[model samples]
Target: MILDKEILAGLIEGSPYPIYLILGEELRVALANAATLKAWGKDASVIGKRFLEALPEIDGQPFEALLRQVMRTGEAYYAVNDRADLMIDGQLKTFYYTFSYQPVKDADHQVIGVVCYATDVTQLVESASNISRMGLEAVENNERLAAINEALAASNEELATTNEELTESTRLLELSEGRFRSLIQQAPFAICVIRANDLVVTELNDRYLELVGKERTQLDGKPIWDGVPEAAEVYAPVMEKVFQSGEAFFAKEAELTLIRNGLAEQVFVDFVYEPVSDLSGNVSAVMVVGIDVSEKVRTRHAVEEVEERIRLAVEAAEIGTYDLNYKTGELVGSARFDEIFGLGNGVNRETIIDHYHPDDVHLSVLAHEEARKTGRIFYEARYIPKGLPLKWLRFQAKVYFDANGNRLRTLGTVMDITVYKALQQQKDDFISIASHELKTPLTTLKASLQLLVRMRENPNTVLFPKVIDQASRSMDKITELVDDLLNVSKINQGHVGLKKNWFNLSDMLEKCCIHVRESGSHELILEGDKSLMVYADEHRIDQVVVNLVNNAVKYAPDSREIFLGIKSLGEMVKVSVRDNGPGIPADKLPHLFDRYFRADERGTQVSGLGLGLFICADIVQRHGGEIGVESEPGQGSNFYFTLPLGEKEE
Candidate 1:
């Protein structure tokens, strides 16, 4: 039968032991029983508060750390006779308790919360201490009575009186011894006693037996090594020193390798071996007390390993990380963050902000405002670092807040995305240019067709031929644009094929610009290397020359003369196209040959998809040649390419 949450809560409320349930990494107190509330010296007001908020005094204590460790590792932690300093009645008081923090799992066996069960053992711990003191007193009293009995043995009356007194003292001593033994047996932590002479296990509690993975029967009258031989080598010397010098030995979080359940395992413990003396003041035995802390040690190691891995991954990716304090305006950043901004360490927010492009500063402000509302920060903007070109950076962060709804700090990462941004801008420009270029030709064709239909009806022979020619030119323009796009696609797909043949370079250059010359808008002057021959694809080389001449005509429209020159440089022939119009800007010249890059610096609309120069460069490079352009803002532009001169194979 499945129980409802209310029923389960009711059961916990009636439990004698203190019980509470905390949820999530924040340890929000989901439910607490009356016993728990009373033990914590708190009221019902702390029901929905975080564990630390309800009991703020426990902030620096191990309880919170242990609870968090249980949540992270999904492993339960148990502590016996643990000390806790708490606020009670407007004063800090210390208390001892035996408690456990068990992970609360969901249906899928995933840890979702922690359930703590505690039993206050303050009175028991105090009582055990008092009993130990009384036992020591009883031993001294017994020794004193032994001397008194020996002196009274010479007189019958005194001897009889001393014998009766001795009987009473003997009974009291036996009672104290019984109480001491019971206290040791009932103690929450492990305890054992071994003789100094033989190192035999004279006395031990159930907890000690369980700790060493042994039964009481096997170790009752045997040496400690007989039951657990693996620990003898590590602990024997320490025990011997305590016995010889009558000094106690203590170890905190010491690791020991022991064979338990037929398997060797590592164990961590906080323990002490105290020397016990006899009536003669000589060390008679050693009392050992220990508490296992292996789980805490393992949990800490696991957390460190995870953090180290994350640090390595961040360093490998060169991701810049930062933490900003909202209230104090304090900024802490990684080395990569400084590297991204071209600044040294100890840079502040203002110094970093100074590097952002002025136009994009408003973007970051708007993003931060939105982050305060939505708890997330994301924006992309331009940044100009010292002595470096403009770059695009993507910023992402998460805003944090306190439980009282006050804004805390923000943790974030930044990445350089200049290449991605350039590619994206190119894609957008290509789409816009392609749409306009294709539409103009399509609209003209539609108009020409309509005119032709009307002319056919009217039987005007002169206008009919002109309308047909116009439509045919429009179709050719559309076909050329489509071919340019297909060529770019084929190049990107690595499927562009080349057919090489020995051809005259000067002859190809002359016929390449026949269409440009027919327009009468410019003069195509051919010069240099008239007889130079190149072993390459003749058609492709012609396409390169045509593209360069067309580019000069479209960009340098006012210039009438376009010089196409060739030079014979020993084994290679060079082809050049020079325009007398305004040259390209220095900044734009770098991106002139880039895909979808147009040298329209004046913002004037130009036809074509800006694929001509990119295609030319690709074709020339494929044929084992070089291509380049040299131009300044005011000087006329000069574009050139070179191809190896080859001889025909016999």
Candidate 2:
């Protein structure tokens, strides 16, 4: 009868094993299962094909003899140490078998075909070999009969110890098994098991499932290579080598090309394929464990690019970069150093040294020589261009060395400061020139005026008072110019300071008004806060008020009235000089207090330097107050300032 279930009758409708076996034999029937038969390296269709034909290499000799013995004797036999040679994939392989064979007799007690049951015993044989190597050793007792008799007592003690050891070993084995399972299941990296025979996935952990983007149930019986094509392509060759050689292999920063969201991204993986061996030391499968390192790779690459860009930028800016070899008295420079020094863009040891000014070259040479002895080099010097003016450069350097304690080189940066240096020199020269040229005339004029004053009392002098008065006025004008210049210079140098003393704001304002009225043609009016006491510099504040009033009298000469007022604003004092004269033009108001600025086209006739308001501003600032002006063309101008009162001094 056909053993195929669909073609069988009602009696064949039980479990498929019995319907196919038709005999009381478990292994024989299980061996007939097509799926199980495939594991033995036979074609799946060998379920119906005769076993002899499927395994021709092992069909004769011991296998055939065992089958005949079971059939003719009508007996059952079991053997776990069976060995045979079989052809698999056209290669001869030695295989071990665990099988039981029984005779199937007809109703008349006649034997039919043999029932063969089997399982692969290759793994068990290797385990047995390992057990033999680790088995308890024996010692021969060859002493006297008395020692032999004492062996009986020792036997009982040894047996008890052996029992205790067996119990401990069992406990240890349980613990080790638990740890093994935990390690496989809780690994941070993906872990997967592949069948060595078929290259198919047999089991996978949650991490592996997540890596594949699939459920375990869907991937359990599938080939690992089929799902992860990129992974397969990258590691399959190594995996093949691992399986064939039964060795473990690893890869670092292996690139895996994957497509996600219709875009391709490269992933780097640090992975290993360890051979999962049965006790025989033959690889049965590969255990793959991998960590994703794509982020690390990308980060390193980005950092390298940023560093490269910074290096290029420093070079392109023509910044003279340097590193000093302190121990060797050597200097290194970037490519731009040559061009900066007016050398022909070829950077070398000689080219860098040639950039130093001739006068400064000895200093640089000495500095490096000193650094060679002291292990340090840092300086700022001027380098004279070959055919041009000298240029200033600053060098910032540090020394570093390797682990061997040998001083290597100094790394440094340099910059050109020529323009700034030139401007500073020009400023100093101007100050010196102004002092000599301007002060000389004032001294000569003062001396002449003094001699003229001495001749004023002579009998022959007619217009002596008028001449003296004109000379005094001229001296006054020159003194004002000198004072303004000194005041501005002090302010620029951050040296302007208040010389404070107890004074009345009202009295100071009146004094300033008296001076302005005496010196100008405009009529003056004084008003407000006669008792307002302020803590301030008496002379400087007097200068500010007088300067403002005088400026108003000069600029607004067309109007006759000028007003000087001092008042209390909160705890502070406000002093103002107001004029009812043709005021400052709106266009010139912004620059009214700028040094050496004149508000009108009419010059030399005004008979004063244009530094009155500038000095006024400086004096007010030094007193920790503010100065301001209000004006409209053809109307009037009011210049005012505020200072802290004595009550608000704190």
Best lDDT goes to which candidate?
1
TM-score for all models, in order of appearance: 0.55, 0.36
Q: Kindly list the per-residue Cα lDDT of model 1 for residues 1-650, writing each as its tens digit.
A: 01232345555777666878898777989788898889989998898688889999988999888888999999999786799999998889999987778897642357879987776768656855775697578787788678767868767778777787788878887887887788788887788889989989988899887787778888888998888888888888888889989998977668988777777889877678878888789999988877766665554445335545656677787788887888888786777887888888677888777888999878888998998689889999899988889999999888878777677788888988998988888788788888988998999999998887777668687777888889999999999899999999999999989998888887788778777778888998888869887899999989998898888888888889999999988888899999987888888877888888777733355788889899999999998899999988668899999988875469
The global C-alpha lDDT for each of the candidates, from Candidate 1 onward, is 0.82, 0.63
lDDT tens readout by residue for model 2, 222-304? 88767666567656788899999987786655787755333466777656787766545678888776656555455444533
Off by over 4 Å in 1: 1-40, 43-93, 96-178, 194-204, 208-269, 273-286, 293-430, 445-550, 557-578, 593-596, 601-605, 610-628, 640-650
**Per-residue error (Å), model 1, residue 426:** 7.0
Best candidate according to TM-score: 1
Candidate 1 TM-score over all chains jointly: 0.55
Query: In model 2, which runs have C-alpha deviations exceeding 4 angstroms?
Result: 1-459, 513-515, 601-609, 647-650
| Model 2 deviation from the true structure expressed as Cα RMSD, one decimal place | 30.5
Root-mean-square deviation per candidate: 10.9, 30.5
